[model samples]
Target: MTKSDPNRILRRLPLAVGGLGAVLLLINRLLTPELTESQARGDVVGVILSAVLILTGLIWQQVQPRSPDIVELIGEEGFVLAQDLPEAVKTELAWASHLLLTNTVTRSLIVYYQGKILLRRGILAAKAEVTPGPILKRVLETQKPIYLVALYVYPGRIEFDYLPENTQGVVCQPIGNQGVLILGANAPRSYTKQDEKWIAGIADKLAVTLQE
Candidate 1:
């Protein structure tokens, strides 16, 4: 159930309905002796043109690539509930970053437990220690997500100093007391409140899954 799946279905639905209606109209016009041959031909031509355009649009949409969100991945790539903790965490890190369309250089996930990094993924550099700095600390203390639209715009921010040089935006969400999930992107204002909500939901799921 990726985003494209619904889009593809919706795109074809209108075409199906419109084609049926056009067929019915063509049948009625064909039966009507009052319709001139030229008029009938015009109607057929219009229907054919419309159908071809609709089909072409559908094909174009099908060919376009779409990123999948968490919900879609959960349905299409199951076993989130069955996999062990480590596997599930890795799967989630990959899925969350992919769904958010984070830049590869900036995308990262750091799992912290008892004031130390337990796992790291997608980070650009290898540092001696990965601490939950001010931004992450805020997320953990508030038990809420934090989204920095443009890290560079905010001078002296801890994240701007620590994140990859190309990072422009970041989203941080606490995974219970177990860890925090961090997603960074190369474009300013890359994440919205809606994105924060989705990330928070994933963090919560990860926290619960780890506990189980």
Candidate 2:
């Protein structure tokens, strides 16, 4: 018996796709012999097929999604979680606002001090009063973004009664040990590595800002 290497599959994908594309080209050429110039144009079928095949080949190699560098920056820092302030939390909230303004986040809610939820963009459909302090507490405790799949978890915490019918996703980030930045979208796509980096950068900076 012979042992097979798994990596060989990835290396052979391009060749396999190319071969399949060649067979397709041959079949196409045979079926439409008079359209040689059209086929040669390389703009209609061949080029598209080639590009698709190449991408397919790459996908088979266990291509992982790119994670941004910011994740490491904020994932393990244990600071600013044991204090309360009036002005510091406000600054952090402002910074979180900046983060939401620059991204495609469709909905957001910031909870300050005790549990005061500040509506940034869309409304929250949660049950609680949607305060900023509690949310920030969660972020400080978990250091992870909370992905709200729907509006049933904390209906009072959300103010979704005002948004249009195009709501999608939501994300909340705690920054400056005082402010909570909330983001929402109308589509189902969650945060990406780049998004996380931007959030972490803002959060870390906000933390410093709150300290000062």
After superposition on all CA atoms, what RMSD does each candidate show versus the true structure?
A: 9.2, 13.9
Residue lDDT tens for model 1, 156-205: 45543334555566777788975677665656664656666777776777
Instruction: State the weakest 10-residue window (summed lDDT) of model 1.
Output: 70-79
TM-score of each: 0.50, 0.41
lDDT of 2 by residue, 67-159 (tens): 222211111111122234466656566556655555744443434332444433334343324433444357657766665544335553344
lDDT (0 to 1) per candidate: 0.59, 0.52
TM-score of 2: 0.41
Off by over 4 Å in 2: 1-99, 107-129, 132-137, 149-167
